[model samples]
Target: GRGQAPATGQAPPPEGNLRARLTSFVGREEDIRVIGDDLARARLVTLLGAGGAGKTRLSQEAAEAHARVGGGWPDGVWFVGLAPVDDAEDVAQAALAAVGARDTKLRGAAAEELRVLAELTSDSDPLHRLVEHCGRRRMLIVLDNCEHLVDAAARLAEELLARCPGVQVLATSREPLGVPGELLRPVEPLPPEPALQLFADRGAAARPGFRVEDDLPAATEICRRLDGLPLAIELAAARLRLLSPRQIADRLDDRFRLLTSGSRTVLPRQQTLRAVVDWSWDLLDEGERTVLRRLSVFAGGCALAAAEAVCADGRLDALDVDALLGSLVDKSLVVAAPGDLGADGMRYRLLETVAEYAAERLAEAGDDKEATERRHLTYYRELARTTEPRLRGRGQRAADRLLSTEHENLHTALRRALAAGEVGELLCLVHALSWYWQLHDLRAESRHWSGAVAALGPDPFA
Candidate 1:
């Protein structure tokens, strides 16, 4: 009875229970161990990082390891990749289907076929039933790309954790799902050593006799220049099929330009590292894209206050700034970091690649770009103007923050304003940035701005 199967033609049970094992893994032993350890100790673990950071691969490794170790639960490991299914409700259905759960209420043949699962299985709650079927069985359920429906993921995780004691969930996302009992593992970029190793490995696979000895330094340089990001490194290595490692290193000097080629079969956006970023950019609404491009004026990071001041020219309300920043963070276009401000909570920055893409978008947008740049310059110029009077007061910090964030943008805007024959705006900009120049010991820049204004003839405001 234990080994026999019914009339439906399902095969008989195996002679011995054979656990699944991962056949190969590369460059992420430490990460795999960390996630595996967390899954062993906690009921839920979230692997959080930017896109293409190998969350899926790491989760697979951990699942395979759990299957091998034996004592956690005997049922087996189940992984459901949620990337294709966008709806939250469908996620549960997909998981149920993956675990052989069937519903019986349908009238159509297709529905009946699906319903056979529920009729055959003895468990009541589908999710709980799936877990119970794996009773005393250590099961790891992976929820990949949870960032899209974070709230839904959190609710589902809570339900599973509450009802299914034997099940462990390994979730991977761009951001954390903020669930209790969820251990967040932030995945950093691959380390330089393994990154180079990966490059050599892939390169050798593409071309024979691709040794590391001759190309080690150049390979290392490529990794460093690409910020040790795996996807970027892989894309670089793909070029080694045609170019030498040294030539690849040389091309990386203008990485934005050089990192154009990607896998031929993949989606255009996924083909190259630039395409990945461009895909994210394409997903932005016009308003968000505009705000993002305007934000590129800042070199460092920007405060909500500064963003509102510089980015809002009657286009976006000040109240919308926070929400916009949050959206950008969720989209991976902007990153949140600790800030020194007590009033506002955090500072936000763009990745270098994202910033460059935004800058290009701004330049292409023509008059809108110039107009937004004017607003940006005006805001910083006003900040500079206001700070001079309150150098000894609290305003100094605000001024300094603005100056630091908007310095490059301010410089670019000033040059553009002068070149556009907006002499009045140029004078205001020069006068406003004077205090910033003095405070930051930028005497040369201050002199330059002052000369530009002077050349514009006598200022009407003066």
Candidate 2:
């Protein structure tokens, strides 16, 4: 049977009648329209995109528009932000409390009271109640930042969809919840034209005479460089309040270094795109941080097998990579992607900014960079050597996966070895990466490393 409503024989508490208000919405008209249409149709929709893709903003805009359209949902549009809550079960309780579920009547022993409250709230659970409440009435339920509590969100959403036939759900997350009736709206970065307009508009608002002329081209270039991500562009604009557009452009030339300045008013996580990423990084445990720093060696995505080979040391056992990698994904630091490597099944990649941050930490640790480089070189070199003979065999995929994952770190190690006069190690790594270089059309790098190795007076091994 469908779950019973609150046992508090009393009537469900009064709905907060608070009209949804749009604080601000920018550069996502198309997204707003798409989601607004879904809400009008009472379809369950999920907005899937990377962090800072403005999923929350889009969801808010959809809610406001639905409210404006002749009170689309009779129960009224309700928003439950889940970013602060970590525990899954607590997520449901928070949602209930947010929607005005009264706990006064839920009395008994602590456990029994909770059970009573859960049942009471369960029936009045806005999502559940929204169905009967809808009865040809229309309402919108907005769940924001649900990636952290996806299981709970999924269960709640499932329950709501099954019970609340007339209600529409609009959720924002970094990924999709694989539930029936879920329509995925993939949010892309802002297009160049609107992105430039947004930057100019915001800049003018911040500084009255901020013009976009010769600097317009530079500004456009800056926006393009940031991949037209709104949060990144806005951050670059905020710096203009203190720096000239040209100066901003020049600084942005090294985005990893320059993008650190954050907004004064925004949450630390939302200050700059980097800070947003750092917030996620700061939440990781020591083991997770160690795994991330080592994994940073990989420029492209890597499979679990390659990760185990490269990141695992005496401190971290081979078996620990899976659990650690899963944690990283949960923290949104490392992202999983599809892989061509058959046995490993999935591949992972670090964002460029995250990789740079990890690399900086790796260098700052005062560990013997050379020794670490040696371990890195030797691991990849042996991997290259073993996999080279089976270029067309099953082993080729594994070898290529390792080489691709270790490409940047391998280059950095090779350069360091060459600088430090470790000629033998450099030669071994160069030879091992040969097949990888060829397969990935990185012949130029191979040629450069080969030339560097040859410049040595003699093989250091000799």
Candidate 3:
């Protein structure tokens, strides 16, 4: 499950400090369509995506749309915001409060006090009250920011879905709850056209008469560079008051530094790209964090075997690599996609902003940067040498495709090998990849590596 929904949109209205946003909702037509269909069919639908991917906003849109269509959720849509609540035990109480289901007797009392009074005098648990209040009441429940309290939210959702047949849950989280009867919808960045439209809309609002047509190319470039992430694009557009769209596009090379401004009223974790990423980073255990940092060493992405060879060691040994990698993907810290790596394998990657954050973490780790780089260099070197043979004969095209997908990683590895003066590794990599370099017409890189090999003189053994 994604988690609980936030208090937004007209159906739920603003109550109990739940204020709607001033900015207009942007693209996500496909997301809204899929989630609406899921809600119609599945009882539990989770909107899963990265922290700033606009899961909550999409959920709000879905709920409002459902309300407008008279989908027969008689009790209406209830949104429970769990971002501010840290303790697992508080999750149920937060939901109850969101739905206005807390005991009426202690209405004006402090929340902690209300909890104590209810626990001491009443035999009913918050879950029981929620179940009783919502019994036979057809309604949709939205859980927002469930990543931190996933266990508690999952348990609550499981019970609610089981006991209340009339209740449906739509949650937004960085990952799913992995519960039975759950539908996971992966939300992605907007496409180029919608991204440009969203930027235009917000950019005009940010600076009166900011004509998107005048800077259409630069604005498109901005969206492309930001990978069409809603929050990132919004933050960049917010800068139009001070900087030109071209400046925004150019400065994106250092996104963390450039995309720093965010509305102070929002959560600090949501104020900037780095802050959103940090919220996810702070959730990882030591092994996951270590693997994430190490995997950032790869430029494009890595296959499972490549990841195991480069990232697994010490506490995160080869045996644990698969599970750890799976966990990262589940948590949305890493993305999994089908690739040309191999028939049986999938490629995994960090988004550019995420990879940048991991690189910062690696720089700060200071424990085994050298060792990790050496392993990465060694792994890719051996990989090239072993695969070079396959690049001949009938299998040539397949091998070429595989190497092309890994070209960025290969370049990064070779650069490190050269810098560290690993003569054996450098020579072997150059010899193995020369055909690929030539096949792709990378004349300059081919010449440079071949020249370096010749400068190293003949192999002593031959």
For model 3 the TM-score comes to 0.89
The alpha-carbon lDDT assigned to residue 208 of candidate 1 equals: 88
The alpha-carbon lDDT assigned to residue 255 of candidate 3 equals 91
Model 2's lDDT to the true fold? 0.67
Q: What ranges in model 2 sit over 4 Å off?
A: 1-44, 65-74, 83-137, 147-165, 174-197, 208-221, 224-228, 249-268, 272-274, 282-287, 315-319, 338-347, 360-376, 383-410, 431-448, 454-462
Ranking by TM-score: 3, 1, 2
Q: What is the C-alpha lDDT of each candidate?
A: 0.69, 0.67, 0.82
Q: Indicate which candidate wins on lDDT.
A: 3
Quote the positional error of residue 348 for candidate 2 in Å.
2.8
Expressed as tens digits, the lDDT of each residue in 257-324 for candidate 3 is: 88888888888888888999999999999888989998889888888888998898766778688888
1-462, model 1: which lDDT tens digit per residue?
A: 111111211333221122333223457766766666676677888887665566777776655554454425445566776666768766665566665531332355776765686554544555555545444545667777777677777777787777777777888877677878889887777887888787887777768889877867888888877766677777887787788988988876466667766767545545777676675675567778878998887766777777887677666787676677678776656877777655564788776667777888889988777777677767666765666666557777765765665566667768777887788878877876676677778898888778877887776688
**Candidate 2 local lDDT, 1-462, one digit each (tens):** 001111211332223333334233467766666666655454678887656667777776556654554434555666778887878877766666554332423354677656754565667354454344434545567878787678789888887677767667788876566678888877767888888887887777667888777487789888876766677777777777788887887776466556656657556667667666665566667888888887766656666776887777778887897789887775556777776655556889875556667777677656633344556666656666676777667777666665565565567667767888888787777787777778878778888888888887465677
lDDT preference between candidates 1 and 3, better one: 3
